[model samples]
Target: MCATLVGGMDRLKREYINAAKANGVELKVFTGKENCISEKMGQTELVIVFTNKVSHAARKEVMHYAKSRNIPVRLVHNCGVSSLRQNLATN
Candidate 1:
């Protein structure tokens, strides 16, 4: 499955990708600092957002984009690798 992750610690980006890979998911992560976040989240099967780390505008955009496309969004406040795996496993 393909997943897009927004927020989470920038230092753990590689770990996040590895964790997703271990779960058999292809994950694209955005730290919320970049421009055009919603546009970059292309064709994902799932949208995982770290609520505590992401900016309000970025979160809003992600929600809108995912809703419009009928894609599932998972909100994780903790933003840990373990939490990511858990969310990915759930669906």
Candidate 2:
């Protein structure tokens, strides 16, 4: 599976990436409000937003892209690695 993660600290990002890799998931992370390309969206299976850290515009864009492609999205307030892992495990 491929996942797009928006926002999180460097340490948390590393941990989250490691966790995803361990679970056989490829993760693409964005820490800023930059727009994602359609080619990238094509490879993404899910979108995870760390609500407290990401900008509203970035979140909206991601949600819009995912919705257009019918990909699943998970919104979590915390940007911790454990929270991300837990959310990802459900889907």
lDDT of each: 0.93, 0.81
Cα lDDT of model 1 by residue, 1-91, tens digit: 8999999999999999999999899999999887889889889999999999999999999999999999999888998999998998898
Badly placed stretches (over 4 Å) of model 1 are none
Give Cα distance to truth, residue 74, candidate 2, Å: 0.5
Per-structure clash totals for the candidates: 0, 0
Superposition error at 26 for model 1 (Å): 0.3
**Model 2: colliding residue pairs:** none
Which stretch of 10 consecutive residues in model 1 shows the poorest summed lDDT? 33-42
lDDT of 1 at 66: 96
lDDT of 2 by residue, 1-91 (tens): 8988887776576788898998788888887456664345558888888999888787888888888889888999989888888878888
**Looking at candidate 1, what is the lDDT of residue 50?**
97
